[model samples]
Target: MAAILSKIKTEAEGTLRLLWKKIDPNDLKPGDHIYSHRRYGLYSHHGIYVGDGFVIHFIQTETKNNVLRLPKAEKFAHRPPCPKCLYDEYKDLGVVRTCLDCFCCHEEKLHSIRYFVYGAPRVGLLLKKSGTCTTLVSSRTANEVVEEAYELLRSQGFGEYNLCQNNCEHFATFCQTGKKLCTQMSFYHDLEEWVKRRIS
Candidate 1:
């Protein structure tokens, strides 16, 4: 998906922008839900933009080693015991903050999804792609969303990462909307079942 964030754009020529809008790196705002395709859209990773060129996200321990391979952010994480950032502390699967450069480096292109979309709920259905836009509205403010992510990272309250039950998308959506759900996982799960039924 070719999506980026500047602000919500609508259908109108000069109005707010909607789904799949390509935006400059400077456009991302705090608490914005962003994602990127992984393995040719087999799945997408999700995270919350927490301002100051940083993003908060949930990662599995095995993947953490891979993430560490990315070029370190300007002001975060030294090889061992970086005093400025919490690189050493997040040893297992849980929330951690990293610069946008490191987060976006996981994939070739980064896409963003929005919670509380402007148009009707049916729009989301039409999009058909999970980890994109959602019709549900978020009750929390952007700052509140950012705060929730920080709180979770600080407290390690999200629990172990589970592909079926709990995952990164769940962590991000929860912080943005206070709801823990992963449409991406559900989308694939249903597709798998449908394929099984089709053949057998």
Candidate 2:
């Protein structure tokens, strides 16, 4: 019995060490901005990386806009809906706190980037405002910023999913700097300009 217990403890410790090695503990801090580019490279999504192998982000449920309902006599009428179809019908989307593993593992390949915010040691007492104005700047510790963002996510959630306005990047920027802005929009605009120049 003693030998078996010792082996189990050793295995558990080794497993934990391997898990921690995958994500460097020093690399991730509360309120750090993490983003990943979509497979097509046209857009990216952002999230807040809190400690303990977790990230907070907004998710929008995709409605089945083109669900086909064939006639009763159709050959496929007797076929059952797949598990994904059922999930799409019942899944709820919005601001959610999920494990980092789930966030990274997707069918579409993604490249992730992390951005660190300054003034993570000083605690400032000021409410973050939305938009481009940076008049009321305040410093906050990383933990404090993470707490405030988590509270907002738990209490208020978000308004709606707007690609141009309210998006994942906007949410993450707001969490770190108290300003809502989409960095990808500028990239897209620049790409559009480059295309126009090529055509002209």
Candidate 3:
């Protein structure tokens, strides 16, 4: 069991490095953190070192816009290969470097939506139709959420929206006041619940 876990870790790292090299060969590194240009506060940690300019990292398959449809489904199981994996199999196209960031989407406008939280990191944007909102669960200060929210809204084409954080008697209050952001676990759990609730 221990050996298997270790091997998995090693493989994960190698995969991450290869992915990174394909994206930003010059700036990729193991253990390096990255943020989405569209969503503030959402970040992925635990990059793998593939030496000689390569790194691999994990990214969520779904975001808030695309909530989890099947919660019990295993991650990375039975799913089609990602662009990195595909590129690895066929490197003759020279697609690795250019398609790293966008995964060869070729879409000029790439927007990352903040759809879920897994850990206690207050990173990434929580986007909605009205505007984009930032998580406030990581701060004790009541103003932090508001400040971040304002910044988030402004960044997401809501320049005229006023930022306000209201202390709350309930969950929505936290969002209203930006009082306390939930831990990533809490956010994830709640997000899943929300998905279930909405779908149900």
Superposed on all Cα atoms, model 1 deviates from the true structure by an RMSD in Å of 8.1
- For residues 1-200, what per-residue lDDT tens digits would candidate 2 score against the true structure? 99977776665554334322334436887776666546644565678888777778766633323233435324332323223222222244566676664455344333444342222211110221121112234355678668867976777566677778788777777777777766467556766999999999
Pitting candidate 1 against candidate 2, the one with the higher lDDT is 1
What ranges in model 1 sit over 4 Å off? Answer: 1-17, 62-93, 107-120
lDDT of 2: 0.56
Worst 10 residues of 1 by lDDT: 7-16
Candidate 1, position 146, lDDT: 95
The candidate that wins on TM-score is 1
Per-residue lDDT value at 169 in model 3: 15
In model 2, pairs of residues that clash are none
lDDT of candidate 3 over 1-200, digit per residue (tens):
99977776665554334333324445543222222233333422122222343323222223322344566534523423345434332222210211233431212444331222212112223222112223333232324433433343234322221112111111222323434332333455677899999999
Residue-level lDDT of model 1, residues 77-98, one tens digit each, is 4345324444443363578887
As a whole number from 0 to 100, the lDDT of residue 98 in candidate 3 is 18
Worst 10 residues of 2 by lDDT: 121-130
Clashes of 3: 21
For all candidates, what are the clash counts?
A: 6, 0, 21
Q: How should the candidates be ordered by lDDT, best one leading?
A: 1, 2, 3
